[model samples]
Target: MSNSEPQRQATVADSQAITVQTEHGLYIDPQALSAHLPALSYRDNELYIEDVSVSGLAKQYDTPCYVYSKQAILDVYQAYSDSFASLEHQICYAVKANSNLAVLGILAQAGAGFDIVSRGELMRVLAAGGQAGRVVYSGVGKTYSDIEFALQQGIGCFNVESISELSLINEVADQLDTPAPISLRVNPDVDAKTHPYISTGLKDNKFGIAHEQALDVYAQAAAMSHIEIVGIDCHIGSQLTEVAPFVAALDKVIELVQALADQGITLKHVDLGGGLGVRYIDESPVSIADFADALLPKLTELGLKVFFEPGRSMVANAGVLLTRVDVLKPTEHKNFAIVDAAMNDLIRPALYQAEMAVIPQQLPNGGMQADDTKTWDIVGAICETGDFLAKDRVLALAEGDILAITGAGAYGFTMSSNYNSRPRASEVMVAQSQQQLIRKRETIEDLYRDEMRWQDQ
Candidate 1:
């Protein structure tokens, strides 16, 4: 009965029994919703993000827009910063979550570093005013140009995933006549117990060097003149509902660090790459503070600079996908609420089978009957049968109703596409009770803005 065990058990219990009944499916249990989305509330029967009403945002931006609470993003970052205040650490926000320049700008201003996987992401961090020396590049397949670009920018370090990549980076650094900071991303073979699509710390996954070979890799890295071995890192996976996997991964990382020290390969930092999951459905993820409390005692004993790359935990609950019901169709086997927002706007549901809370801005005709509580497959206008935001969702709604799909801040717009030539949606940030459009809705012309029709022969 450790201190965190009871808390974990309680959260699991709460998630199991609590379901806020809606029209057909259940909204996120209020307890989990409040824990994750502290800035959201219902006022005048309308869902609001911070002080901006969902109704008002729909009216102004039209439907199928992204609405975020500026405060929510700040709050989550502050929680991480405050919880580890006593430690030497850097909260390197994973940029792939939501790379809207404004999102990056806000994080950069808050003294957050960045974890980038691509050269374009490196440019975005710089464009958003993030310091070059605070950026950490992580990915398995960084190209020659990627290595050249990162070295030119003088990034903090590269979380090298393979020996080949280390050699390539060394070559690039030598070509540029500079020392490149390197951190071997060791595959700890720990089961993150998450979705297969995201699990990265296993031996079979093509993410990092194997755990047993990490010491040898460190020795190889030390032999390279252009490589400055700075740190050790491992990311198990994303959307982790429990803290045990992270702890397991870190324990292995620490063991390797000691082994490397015995070999005279001293490290500067220990990067516990972030995959802390947020409550999307019935998940009871460890709170950032509790997670830190669980690991800080051991982390402090190591006395090395700590680095984190939290993505979803920082932004998933801060934004909502605002969509409008376009039409309702009922058949013998199913009821459908087709929305204007399609798979091109948010792909998690179709891709990952992910679930999110879909709450109507107002109930159908402001009321619902027992029969009106029919379960509806909330789908998008995309032609694919798989194009859905949520299936068998219970929601009280009308044809023209607006729905806020909660828990969409991370991996939402960043994963969006222009498939079917559908223009992407706009984005709005609500702060201090005021709304500002962060991204403009793409126009039909913008879809073909760069395409040129071939001349007739």
Candidate 2:
């Protein structure tokens, strides 16, 4: 089928049955593919992301690049907006997940306010055409200058973390002669039941104020001359799969909101910081519809504007890291497939022990034969032993074969680095058959352009 031709949905006899496309054939399970990814599918023995061939992108962009489906992102964002359509809510796309200007621009144009952590993120949101009034500043550390910048921009609210940070914001606002819109991020201490590293609501985590101290803190904020308590905020953690923890957290937040209201502190909104999970493997995350169904009623009863700071769920599965196998080594102990993309290119696998689904861009004629497949450790070129992508993955592979690392759109490039002095990869956004290079691949000199040379010194 041509790239411009609309893809026909394949009917399946059973959910597990692999649907064979007779015309321009390929053995693919459409149901299984849809369950994992939205805009990706197999056609003519090649994987296509929104009708744009993944292998074609690898060849065009020259491997070790990030490719995102524009439609996928829009669809996901639309789903979130549609689910909460019944409520007075704002779906603030968390900019920290994937801060690429194009991604930001897409979300901004689609009416997504941003949840930023720093001045730089706020600037990025503005540069991408997002309104400062729709932005919510959030983080543990906010320097005087950062607070001043955000205040100058007239951001919607500040998700104040600590009491000291709250004081700092008030101090900056006083100097600016402006009442800074704020939200005290309360630590509900509700276990998000996610990875410990990503969990932020626990008392031990340095994210928000203790749940018990929220009312007292609000009293403190209420007394501050320059601090305007516009709302309350709480983010338990990232990659949360279940709805119980969210409902539990909301219940606590509601209780606190009522207590504050009783104290004559009527807030305008409630920021239920987002941690909705996406399917990285066999995991069944709560659907956006289900999430809204779980929390919308309580929020409606509260009769306050709602704000969701979704990061991963907005873009994680919308993009992939495209890399080529540079070398294949077979040893008695273990088999290793070293790809050009390293930990510096995508670090979640190393940092969070995240397991991303690695699949070939192009499949063999009749899929992989038993002899052609082997259990291989997909390692990167980085020097660290922890620099690995997938472990003990059974796949039909060869040197020079292009692979797509799924679930890379969120923290993949945003958390990447130039470790080992390796240039960062380029980023591309695919919309149907058309492709656009959102970011250029970094050059070796680009890395040290701002550094003072020893000879010059």
Candidate 3:
């Protein structure tokens, strides 16, 4: 085929298979997979994550498992620390992204803090050896018990979202005879230009307090006997690709900070919340250095400690979902590669319509030819039609082949479910050549381990 010709073109075959022509050769270029995920590379035509072989992981610890690179996670965390080395800051890993105890432990050991949404997350952080003094409790729904537990544990701060939440925190603090350290999560009304479901700072979203009412809220908080206004927080959205929206949001937040300072409510810190996007496919996300460079000057001007709550950018590219192709059904219109992993295993594709990159763990024997490649809709065994991972991917695939779904570290296992009564997948962490089983695959009995029998009742 000519270089100017389209790389992927659809055609029907004798078996009525929908085949797609390759760019130049038969095999899918391994470089395509490794370019974005630096920790993954092909060795002897076999894909490997760090020094461990992908196929080896599947053979030893079954398919439908999550494999993460320990070094990759630390490298990303270190990059964040290095980028902001000139400032007094705290990188709080958002636990909702990947709450696996092992993952939390890895970050905690590396001198990282945590951003928790509930008391349960706080418990996870503590269980993973994360210090309570470094945990910041977020989320709009903080129950009475959640507040009591966090306060008792001596959490760093509470990112209070609403006026009622402020009152409740103050009440709980007053009852405990302690001052509750807080930061009013302000809604700057800046559009993050991300997915609607993940957007928060807009006026329409149910996140922080309104921008106009922020100063008044601060005043209300200052008068409360037990409320201690420590900082100001703003998070516009998640998976933000561009730096413009963040700078725009920060400008608004800077104005509010200046206004607060003018009102004699000087804050101790400012939390420009984390929404940095990662490259799942073709997206050109801003680098950590670039992101910090864009906002650090303003932050330095404020002369307060900085805080970031990054979740996806830290772990998304550090892991992959390893699954096995159980069957392949070719049709006249489209082909389906049924994998063992389902939406219950990784729900991003189903929930957010995300398109994850799926590549083979090993090349086909003797190398594949142009005719061997086919267009496939990589679907799961789940009954729902939305139980798919990637759509219209042209790859040389076959039965029993292991496929690695890239950019799955964050929100992969944390968001998994027991839908259709399928047990959750195992989690493995790899460092160089060493592999450790962090979480074992759930059993069929695990699905109902807490349920009671109707007859017994």
Candidate 4:
């Protein structure tokens, strides 16, 4: 059948059971793919994100493109907002998750604030029409220029990580003659029970001030001339699946807040840093509502403004990385499906040892039929041996078949690099079946645009 042809449903039966063929013609996996991917479905034997075909997107935007569903993003953000409806809060979409201008614009329009870790991110938020008063500046190493820039922008608050950072912000604010609204990101030392790399609240991790030292730090901050201690914040880790750690961290934060109040330093808000995990493979992470439900009561009792810095939970499932298989090499030991998208396009698989869902853009009329299936290692074109997307994944794939790398919306493009001098992929956003190219694919000439060859003697 042609790539654009409509899919016709078919059924086959055996003595044991009968299997129904979906639009993409997969029969073996009985579970609906749509259940996992809310915005994804098979239409006419082609993968459709909402209403647009993935193959059509691949053809139009070229492979290795990052596609996002606007509706999906809105839905996730709204879930967070609705969950905290009873409380005074701000859902600051972490800009690092999917910082495409179009993505930021959509969230900004949806009344979502931003939690930024850099001045560039702050600038992106501004460029995307985000309100400066709604942006919170985060990160451990905020340079003088960044501090001065954020202060000038009238940002909502600075999530100060250290005493030294507080001193720096105070110094910068003094220099700028502006009061810097700030919060101390206290390390509650709560176990996030997640990957060590993403864990931040542990005492050893270099993220926030120690929980024990936070009261003294707050007292010190209250005396600073140019500093206004606005809130208390804690982030345990990224991709957190449980609620106990969050509650534990909040319990510590609440205690600290009360201690500070006794010391005549009352915070106006409390920020529970966003580390809620999303479903990547077989893992079942906490739902947004459940996560909020677990923490909102305590926050309400504290009677302070609440802030959530959700990055992955807000965008991870809203997007996929589209790549085309270049060749299928069957080796003596293992099989490899070499694809055009390398670690440069999506690095979570390499960096976090992340397991992502890999689905074919088009499935055959029947299932793989056992004999046709092979356990293939999805390797990328990057030169490093570690440049793999998935290993030992059983799939029936062929050359030129497009694959959707699921759970790629977060930490996908933002972590992308021009390694091996390869240009970065373009980004597209789908809103109501309309495809919008948010970022143009990088060109060879675009690389090193700022570099100049020095004349040698």
Candidate lDDT (C-alpha), each? 0.85, 0.87, 0.88, 0.86
* Per-residue lDDT of candidate 3, residues 384-440 (tens digit): 999998887767788999999989999999999999999999999999999999999
RMSD of each: 5.4, 6.0, 4.9, 5.6
Over 4 Å off, model 2: 1-14, 17-31, 455-457
* Residue 319 accuracy (lDDT) in model 4: 94
Q: Where's the lowest-lDDT run of ten residues in candidate 2?
A: 1-10
- Candidate 4: residue pairs that collide: 7-44
What is candidate 1's local distance difference test score? Answer: 0.85
TM per candidate comes to: 0.93, 0.93, 0.94, 0.93
Of the candidates shown, which would achieve the greatest lDDT relative to the real structure? 3
Model 1: per-residue Cα lDDT over 1-457, one tens digit each: 0111011123345534334444334533333354446578866556778887888899999979998888889899999999998899999999999998889999999999999999999999999999989999999899888999888888899999999999999999999999999999999999999889988888889999999998888889999989999999999999998889988988999899888888888888999999999977567788998999988988999999999999999999888999999999978778899999989999998888888877777644444344456677899888899999988765556788888888899999999999998999999998968989999999999999899999999
Write the residue-wise lDDT of candidate 2 on 37-127 in tens digits.
Answer: 9788878778888889987898888979999999999999999999989888899999999999999999999999999998899999999
TM-score for candidate 2: 0.93
Model 1 error, position 118 (Å): 0.4
By descending lDDT, how would the candidates be arranged?
A: 3, 2, 4, 1
Model 3 TM-score is 0.94
| lDDT for position 20 in model 3 | 36
Sort every candidate by TM-score, greatest first: 3, 1, 2, 4
